[model samples]
Target chain A: MAPTTQTPPSLRPSPATLAITRIVLIAAAVLFLAPVYWLIVSSTKSNPDLISSNGLLFAGNNIVENYTALMSWTQGNFWRWVGNSMLYSTVAGVLGTLVSVSAGYALAKFRMPGKAGIQLAILGGLLMPIALLTVPLYIFFNGLGLTNTIWAVIIPSCVSPFGVFLGRMFVDAGVPDELLEASRLDGSGEVRTFFTLVLRLLAPAMVTIFLFIFVATWNNFLLPLMMLNSAELKPVTLGLYGMMSYFSPQYGAVLQGALLSVIPLVVLFFVLQRYWQSGLTAGAVKG
Target chain B: MSTLTRPTAPERLVTEQRAQANRRRRRREGRIGWGFFAPFAILFVLTFVIPILVSIRSSFFTEKAAGDSLYGGGGMVETFAFLDNYAQVLGNATFWEGMGRVLLFGAFQIPVMLGGALILALLLDSFIVRRVAFFRLSYFLPYAIPGVIAALVWTYIFSPGLSPINQTLGSISEWLTGLLGNNVDLTIDFFAPGTIIASMATMTTWTFMGYNMLIFLAALQAIPHDLYEAARLDGAGEFDIVRRIKVPMVGQATLLAVLLSIIGTVQLFNEPTVLAAVNPWMGNDYTPMMLAYSSMMGTTSPSGAGPASAVSISMAVIAGILAAIFALVQKRSTR
Candidate 1:
């Protein structure tokens, strides 16, 4: 570690290379962000200005009008869809995170038979793409009289095998054997210890898993497209797709809807990104 | 206690009691462990496992009509279909075409996306790029945006009349043409049937490049600094260290990402489905996933349950095979 601190002068990339790297990175950033920047700018323009005006710059301050149009155009269905999105994402994300994390903690700490089999089943589910099962799920839900209901979306989403895997990784890494033993030795009941120590230890991982599941459920399209037939029940992604798929979409309104849909996600990302980024990297490598 | 190298009878009894208590404790803990695991287990089985089983079963059994011919039937009778659904799917040109397009899309796309991600990750890790936070934020911003919205925005951006992309490209090419004294036709239509794959690839690359980059970056960042020192001491240069140590270290991660991407790409629906709104010629069976979905939607035939399941089963099988092959190769290479 001491020798590496010096980082041999030869190991240092030349100034020319650094400049080149900077230039390349900046160029890539500009290109990469063009569409995203366009989305923000273009959503604020009138339909005519959107096409005729310079694509990079905003011509008119039409964000309010576009938003108004979106509200009126969808008959406030967009707001309902957004609500539904929040509902589904939050419920499933929170539920699945709690369940999986607890299961993971138990698996990590307890002496349980068939834990290996359960883990393998989870792995098998991960390998088999869930998107491919949407059709059959649609039929299955139909049989259970759950189709077009929130359950159709929420129930399936409540089991993220990946989240379980991550939770286990976090438990094994974060919660030491000695700590649990000490807690037990202190006469802390199993449930009490779990709530006080294990839950506290697993907080970051739980949040990470929740956010992952939230984003996944929020962005989910295929499952909803299959099961959701009612317009009022549609999540934002499905709602937006419906708007776009119409014969003649109201471009201005749809743009506003799209913009509205991503705002919360983006803000959440910015706020919690640092917390999850480290957790995620650790889990990604270890898992 | 004093003579023999063995415990007395009381000690043995005490040990037996301890073992029994341990067993009881383990049994209690095991019950609690299962209690914790039960929700995920039940939900997983109800959703994932059951769906696969149902699909397989439905694929193998066809609904038998009353009078054996009439459209109107009595109570539903399901007869053993055997390979009838498989035969239907395999013989269908549309399904094959969709399969072909998906394979073709993945063949080119998986490499380029993963390669771009690898390069970006390496660049970020190299410490040459300034404002790493800014790049990380910008690149990862797309991931936060829902796929439907991203595709919608990209679709608008890809629109012929309204597309900033083509408008920008035309000007760039004109400048290039003037500089090089040659014709440069960089104005390719994204919605055109021929270049639709390119557009899809670009959109996918846009959405995932940063994501995969972060994953690769995680792997790269995990490399021990001492390993770098050791390599340098052995006269390994920057490129050698990067290639031999860094790349190989991240090889498992890259393979994992590739496998995940393979699973993802084959199940491509959102982008292409949206794009088909512009170009209708991609047809109902745009990709194998589309074929399965389209059949289930029953746009062509009424209740294409059997065939949709067949396509679903076939796709899962094909993907399983491809994933297995990739896993085998990676294992062999790593070994």
Candidate 2:
């Protein structure tokens, strides 16, 4: 049988069908890009312009003001949130990727006892709903006195079983066994071989894993909402959420803040778009 | 065959044996690949596995009020509650109501979202769509934007006071007011309670459809080309081929997407919570996750942590049971 998600390639489309497909595809693209367009346009407009002008179209002469307002809105606190998000996502991304890559290598290449069990454990981890664990995680953090700290968010995020699972699959399929054997014959240590030979082969998968974890950790909400309280320690997600809760009526400021928060992510996505798509699927194959 | 010849041969044999031993040592060292996985194993046990065990245990305890204390207090000491929290959760009218809504949302939203994704995926996979990568990235870009930001963006789009939808209505009303030469209004309000569910659905589908599409597309691409050639030789129509071949081929991915949707809908919080902030009618307990959040964080539950814990444990159990039931049904059907 053909793969379900693929197109039925046998049916020759009439000219009308072809035209309709193009239109629909264009429409979908427009729909997808519309919100982003609105974000940028709104961010550029002044408070009054934002309130009065067409939200979908560009208005002149308010970009500087919006930047200043966003920067100064919380007594110069927006950057703090940005920094916090960066610190959390960066640390979690690197460590999570490392763990995933190495773990995946072992699971894919090694003949350790309990390998099947570990693989099953990773599957269970993926299926376990975040909501189910949120409350328990909170209480656990409370016991550790790690609540309201960046580590609470960073540390927990580092243990992504899915990442490790992805790392293992990529290494298994992408890296060659012969290369490792050659390196071993040269008398290099296993660690050195991995760092030198296996890592070079697994670079694409690693980048993909890093981007996935970074986006997840950066955009994460409920965990940070449950964990951190001090604004300085708040990642952008939590900071924006807190602002939404406290300043529900300040549309202009909130709008501006929301726009600012999304820019970096959007830029990151565009830069690393290919990795996310390919990496996500490869990780998802077993499921 | 003299004594000198015997000594040289013995020395050569010793050298050969040492080289052989070194080779064996190297092979063992290289083969013991567990070194690479050590960090992940330690972390997985510490953060992921251990916390789950802790959660199961903590679910049994009742928290004390007036401080950050749980258990060991008057009227708050946790005992062998023995499914009491689960009982309370199942019995709680509000909890069930929230769960029912989630179920309803799941039933309707999953198909719509997946169908939309499938259509898009199929369309993209076809030779008709040009700039394929661009469209793919565009569709998937929203998933990249954090949930909080997605929620925020939708919040603006749906907000009555500031939304373009409402603003356009107001503009039309003003135009009517001028044309009629009388004080008349022609705007239709969308913030009504009845339409809020649809509003939330629109937001979620936008955020997730692309993600589902990517998975479906990947699965689609993995299918071999000869299947299509064979179908063509049989003169199967496009729609027929889709129903018979493509759908079945992507069945595993479709099932996974459904499972994920079910779980996600049950824990629906971010969208509704953000909406509630902008729209007063949504209130604190609009969704079960919201209810749990309020119980734990809101002022009414100064001692609400325990009840919140109870509510969450119940929710988890329900999710578990439902998942089990689903897996069973799927297994039977496949068999």
Candidate 3:
């Protein structure tokens, strides 16, 4: 690995090279940030301003009015959709993290029957796109009268094979076998030791997995679009998409809704940036 | 402690007891291991395995009547129509056209996006750049936004009424016409059928370029500094070092990103679906996943679950095959 802590004085680029590099990077940054700039700027504008004014330019200070109108646009249904999204994402994240982490830890630290088969299954599930399962899942949930309910989304989402794969990798990297042996020697049962000792050690992985699942469930559109028919049960993605589909002059509301849906996640990303970065790097580099 | 110094008989007895306890512990650990695996295993089977089985089974059986269910009910019975749905889905021109469109989109978008990401990553990894952290975060920020929101934001940006792009192009076209004294139209309608794929590609590249960049960046970060020093001692330039050292070192990461993009391209749904709202030409069935979705819901066709299963299964097969081929190629290259 590159010695990131210290750089040799001799290896530093010339002043002109550094200046050129900075210029290029700044240009790239502007390109990346343009849409985000537009999203925030356009959300604050009125409908006429949005249509007539430059998209890159901020036109009016209608943030409060636009947000209020967005919240009250569908008879206070936007907030309900937000709440539903929170509930589903939270439940699925927590439950899915638990299931995946435990399974991953076991697969990493223990010897069990049919372990190879189980590992293969995890790999298969990870590779299989969720789109293939959506149709039958809809039918299965519909048959059980579970469609239009939060469980339809939450139940299927909780079975994240990628989460399990990541959990296993995290366990292998973070947890030591000697520690497990010590815990076992101290008469700690497997479940008890996991809760008191292993869980703490795996906290970073748990947080990453939780946030990953949370964001996935929050951003999910197709599953909820297919599973839930009622507006009350809709997540912000589907709800906002529905709003945008209409020809009504609710572009401002839709933009506000889009901004509102993104804020929590962006906040989460900033706050938990370290864990997310590690998790992502682990997946890409280690796996 | 005494057993260590004790006579053979007592030491033997203690050793036997310890061995028995070890056996007991091993048994218990095995039981607990299965217990730990149970929840995920059950859910995995229920959600993934069962649905796949159901999809495969239904793919072979067409609905004989309108009200027929996969599960026998409603006084409706399904006939064994083996390979019929598969034949329909495979033979369908629209399916092939959609597949071709997606392949073309993937072919154009993946290289540009991944290549752009690689360049950015390489540039950031260079010693010339400072504040690498800020640049990385800025690039990655777009990925945090939901695909739906990303699509929606871009939809506004692509709109002729609100878009700087269209307005700029319109003026440029007028300028060209005036300068040449000939009628020339440089303005391109992004929503038009001929250009929608490129528009969609732009949105996708915007959403995912950062993500792929981060992967490449991570891979680049793992390269040893000694190699760069050696290359520098040999008087290699930055581009030479990147081509000879950094890119070769990050081959696996690049392959992983490409494979992931391949899967993602096949499951292209959200952007096109959202864009279809504004661009009537880019209909719901513009992509394979969308076709499968519309077919599954009977939104675009009356074929019901059988054809939908076939479409989905076909998509899954194609994805599986592409992934397998990539993996095989990667393996061979690494060897």
Q: For residues A5-109, could you state the per-residue lDDT of candidate 2 as single tens digits?
A: 464444446779889898999999999888878876776666667677777777666766666766666668898888888899999999999888988888877
Best-first order by DockQ: 1, 3, 2
lDDT of 1 by residue, A221-248 (tens): 9999989899899999988887788747
- Which candidate leads the pack in TM-score? 1
For residues B1-335, what per-residue lDDT tens digits would candidate 3 score against the true structure? 66467758867888899999999988887888889999998998778887778878888888764354665455555778999999999999888989998899999999999999998998988766667889988998988998988999888788877776776777788999999999888766778888889999999999889888888888888787788878988998777888889998888788878888898899889999999988777777899889988987878873677899899999888988988888898889778
The whole-model C-alpha lDDT of candidate 2 against the native structure comes to: 0.77
Best by the lDDT measure:
3
Task: Specify the CAPRI tier of model 2.
Answer: acceptable
Tell me each candidate's TM-score.
Answer: 0.94, 0.87, 0.92
lDDT of 2 at B141: 82
Steric clash pairs (candidate 1): none
| Candidate 2 backbone collisions, by pair | A4-B246, A4-B249, A4-B250, A6-B220, A104-A168
Q: Rate the local accuracy (lDDT) of all candidates.
A: 0.84, 0.77, 0.85
For model 2, the TM-score of its B chain against the native B chain is 0.78
The DockQ-derived docking category for candidate 1 is medium
DockQ of each: 0.61, 0.46, 0.59
